[model samples]
Target: MKKTFDLVFFLLLFALVTACSPTKFATEMAIDALTGAGSSTAFTGESDPELAAQSLPFALKMYEALLVDHPDHPALLSAAGEGFVSYANAFCQLPASMESSWEKQRHMLQRAASLYLRGRDYALRALETRHDGCIRLLNEKRYDEALENCSKEDVSDLYWAAAGWFGAISAEGFNMRRMAEAPTAYALLVRALSLDEGFNYGALHELAIAVLPALPEAMRYRPNVAPADDPVRTWEADYYHGLGIDPISDPYRAAYHHFERSLKLGEEGLVSPFVAYAEAVCVPQQDYEGFRAMLEKGLAVDMETRPDSRLVNTLQAEKARWLLAHAEDFFVVIPDEQSEE
Candidate 1:
């Protein structure tokens, strides 16, 4: 009887160990699928976004399957949410050329928005697992309630929650349902600043500069400050002007500051900031030379800091291809008289 019991116990222990091993494999598979793991081997050094994008759906499916077994895994939840958003943005929304039909663009945008909303929800779930009540209040658009829940010790949570709400609100069109939330979006951002001034790496300074200057005359009223001492109007001038905005009303200045900061930060292999800077600030200002310079610098730094940085490699190569394809469009010709002068 003792011998028989020992054999049964060993069998059960082996079964448990085997089952546990698959969970790690599933987790790794989920990450690999999201990040284009083996795809990096194909090009010797760099991965292709097109190929990476193709792998995303399969990876996402793997993540979903894994979630069935490990439902509350933080890493899995965050990865799944981000993967959905990235796949939607990269494959669906970003490929529309000017020649593409309007219906296609509309469909893509809507899909992207939905994916972003999913990401937002998942990120919220991750927060909720930690018992963060601020996220719940923010989701309900109860800004004051959310603010009241915030403490100085956990200000980062407050900032991110407000940012998440802003992102969700911005994803919608001018529907009557969303219209009421517009003012609240701006207010929430302000509240985030009040709670944590360093939110967005202080990119809010640029955001404020960009937004305040473009406000319609009537909408520019300083409800947040005294009539004689409105801080928003002055902030619009100071930060924007410092960033090289001519007439101090240009939104592009805000972009310039943020992009510059991104490039500086990308020294450690953060590429999104550099790419965003190029797209939002440099391209809009017709600063092709500056854009090209920044991208080259970004690529060099990224390579040095993280030679295996797959996303950085892909984005840099794509940007180079873009510059090559649209060389003429990016260049401006000066008149002969102006050139001579």
Candidate 2:
């Protein structure tokens, strides 16, 4: 199936090149052929990380090249958006996290942020194509106005745009301008969730575990600041109302709720929920045992059981193993041998 699709794609490309000028029908056919279901499944379902890492750059560049001709092509735009985010996460951000060299890590994170924003722009452009003036409203900070017209069909664009935007913000770390835009990403995700809570096997919920926890940092909440003077508090009061949780007293509750939902929806076939929960929830709460247990569960996952998710599952498992190996770096107190006995 994959070979047949590739052959057809190249034939289309050959036609486009050999002709005096590329016809619209040929270009459209090429776009569809390149971004077809077979291509997506073949790449995603591969188990080899090294192969994926090496191949993804080429694939991503191809998507970009194709986009120059077909700017408004939905499939190409979605592929670009989703591919860049996955590439940044699995290749850039994850590697940066594991790096010991501060300068190298910083450089890698910056690269990740750039890629994430690029992905976000592609996804947002796709959304704009679907709903004109939405991006303009978003830029003007009229989030509610921007998202008002978004419906269920827009969930993929919404999710990828928000994911890439949020990923960029997280990678950049505490830039006030980017931090200010966090609410916009949150609004996008919230809208996506409202439209389809079950999108991508509860991926919306998995993302909430990270995004909700970062609200405090994103808002720049200072413990010394008075409630009346604190923008973070006010923002939380307004935003948290819809999510059904108090950020001031317990910001992690919503994250936990989402974590449970994600785990249930994803089932034992997936490793991401465990890994996300451990890093996002356990580390902050200083639940060392919980952290260890979660990583163990992730590591124990059989990749063969879900061949389509093998690539992602492997990456998540690698992260889980790394976290466990570096557990001492996060925790101040270690239990002695006698205590364990």
Candidate 3:
């Protein structure tokens, strides 16, 4: 009788334990379901930046809530990190760029910086979770292992980590503390470039293009300039620097090449590359015709077919429109094409 009674008691205990466990387990499962569903909806609704801007906060909260219970979930970490980056880029940094008030601009920029740092930290956390001791490896300058340890599949994490780091550095502007992090960001993206040059339709190349041209002469490491007998060898010179032969390296050409490669990789449906090429390369070079052609290329993209890219293209197209409107500010008139002769 005691043996039978003990068996019944243990069975009841087992049932009690499982029944109690299901509440937390089921809640977590529900959170996971909600997160995936919300993310899918957000991706589908990509046409309006304002709508994205409005919805991101809620999505971020959902990610954070999930993270509280499931801190090491790679998907959650990535979503949180990318969410912060998208928010800062679309809402914070863009507006901050336009705030002419010194004090207000400074305030806006600082907020953007905070968001970038948060994103960077979250992305780093995701990496650390993926690879044990990764943070220590990175800090110790064990870049070989840090870069090699991650497989090709981890490209998004690497890219976003670099993006967030660079975003923070850019927002800091001249602040020496954050500016020092640029090389770290550069290394991260370089690793991503090595893993997949075609990642995100050449977004990796776009990022490197932005950084390469803006590198301070001191920070830029380049090979010795080739002899003048071989002008073609000039192309062999590192774009960021050229052994001081030119005093300042001309990275713009190389940057432009990346933009072209990006467009080719993108094939169609992406307009940001065109806008970026015009603003960062053509306009600065005073190539009015090239600038106009690039913007027209951006405007020509059909946003509906590429709905997933619509929001970014919309924002980029607006910039292209603004640049066209202010064309006179960037270029000088040559009177007539034949007059140049």
Worst 10 residues of 1 by lDDT: 37-46
TM-score of 3: 0.77
Candidate that beats the other on lDDT, 1 or 2, i.e. the better one: 2
Ranking by TM-score: 2, 3, 1
Per-residue lDDT tens digits for candidate 2, residues 146-240, read 77777888898889998999899989997878887876787678778777878877889888888777676435343355668644345445545
How far residue 148's Cα lies from its native spot in candidate 3, in Å, is 1.9
Tens digits of per-residue lDDT for model 3, 305-328: 566667777887777787787778
Q: Write the per-residue lDDT of candidate 1 for residues 114-165, one digit (tens) a residue.
A: 7656665654555455555756665564545555444443433333333443
What overall lDDT goes with each candidate model? 0.50, 0.80, 0.69
Per-model TM-score on C-alpha atoms: 0.56, 0.87, 0.77
The parts of candidate 3 lying over 4 Å away from their true place are 1-23, 34-44, 100-102, 220-250, 327-341
| Residue 228 accuracy (lDDT) in model 3 | 57
**Model 2: ten consecutive residues of lowest lDDT:** 217-226
Better by TM-score, candidate 3 or 2: 2
Displacement of residue 168 (Cα, Å) in model 2 is 0.8
By TM-score, how accurate is candidate 1? 0.56
